[model samples]
Target: MTTLRLGFARGGLEIKQFLRSRESVVFTLFFPLLLLVIFGSVFDAEIAPGVSFTQYFAAGIIAAGLLTTGFQSLAIQIPMEREKGILKRLRGTPMPRTAYFIGKVIMVLAIGAAETVVLVATAAAFYDLPVPSTAAKWVTFGWVSLLGISACTLCGIAFSSLARTGRGAPAIVTPVALVLQFISGVFFQYTSIPEWMRTIASLFPLKWITQGMRSVFLPDSFAAQEVGGGWQLGYVAIALGAWVIIGLALCVFTFRWTDRG
Candidate 1:
């Protein structure tokens, strides 16, 4: 109970810091909106029969917003903190180290939730997006959002160990994330992407997350466009679960408090 309280307080501070940081705000809030509006309006026509491009595209943008917030942002922030001795200083503080990480996870949760709202609201207002209507659909959205954010956040923490300097952080993380975004069909409908490319994407969390979102937002008839012509809910759960485990293990193994080396 005490630890939970401490983590909440620490997380509150992190939220304030996020609000103050222009880069953080823009990426978390603006970038996803930009992508949605630009791509959605331009590709508003149906590339897939019976599925409006906007409807097909909105859900994936929500996942992208969450991924960019938790993965890309943390990848940059963690390495910069280490390089600036922020992590070292925090270690010397009286607070539990776990609280710092909890704080980061909370930051991801807050931003990811906000991003979801923004994407859904924008899509509905501007693009006439179809929302999750059933109780089951909402339930699916809940679990998908939770698991996706957690996996991305943990992966970000693990990948943070890769950057040796503050300047190197973006160079290291952005390309990997951008490549995944391209392959994972964040900016395009997965069905239109090549089968081999989809296979490459299926190996990662982003693809599953986007698929899960599609399962919730798209109509039952829309399943034909999917690789298996179904939601593949079991596969989504398993793939994301595996990534969560792998990410947690990697973070435990590779975490560094300082860049003294």
Candidate 2:
């Protein structure tokens, strides 16, 4: 209980420090919004009868934003901190390692919620995207967000152990993130992608996360357009839940307090 309390306090400091950085603010917070605007403008067509391309794209962007906050950000930030001896210093403190990770999870959840709101609002205001109106839909949104954020954040912490230096972190993380986005249908319609690509994407959390977001925001009929011609909510839940478990295991095994080879 005390560790959790201290972790929350640490999270507060993390949020404050994050807000102070202009580059982080723009890249982490606004980059997804920029992608939304550019894609929303360029692809001004209906994905379905009443749904514009922007509406469909919005959910994917929100999923991607969660990835950026939880996965890409932590993957890069932790290694940089480790290289700077910040994590090493923290390791010697009375704080438990779990508390440190709890702090990171809090930061990612807060930022991810804010990012979701901004993306949904922008889509509604400019693209006529409708918010989810049903209680069940909101419930779906909540669980998906929780599981997706946790999976990505823990995986990021685990992946950070692979980076040998601050300078190498982006090189290791960015390409993987970019490839996931492209292949997981963040930047394109999932059904439009090749079947083999979809099969590969099914192995990852982003594909399931994006599909779950679509289930929440899109019409029920839209599920017919998915790879299996259904929303596959059961599969979505299973995939993300599995990743959460896998990520936790990886974090336990691979997390490092220093950038040691």
Which one is best on TM-score? 2
Could you say which candidate leads in lDDT? 2
Q: What is the C-alpha lDDT of each candidate?
A: 0.87, 0.90
What overall lDDT, based on C-alpha atoms, would model 2 receive against the true structure? 0.90
Pairs that clash in candidate 1: none
Residue 72 CA displacement from its true place in model 2, Å: 0.5
TM-score of each: 0.96, 0.97
TM-score (C-alpha, index-matched) for candidate 1:
0.96
Clashing pairs in 2: none
Summed over model 1, clashes come to: 0
lDDT of 1 by residue, 169-252 (tens): 999899988878887867777877888998999998999999899889888788777878899989999999999999999999
Candidate 1, residue 184: Cα displacement in angstroms equals: 1.1
Off by over 4 Å in 1: none
The CA lDDT at 259 in model 1 is: 82
Where is the poorest 10-residue window by lDDT in model 2?
Answer: 252-261
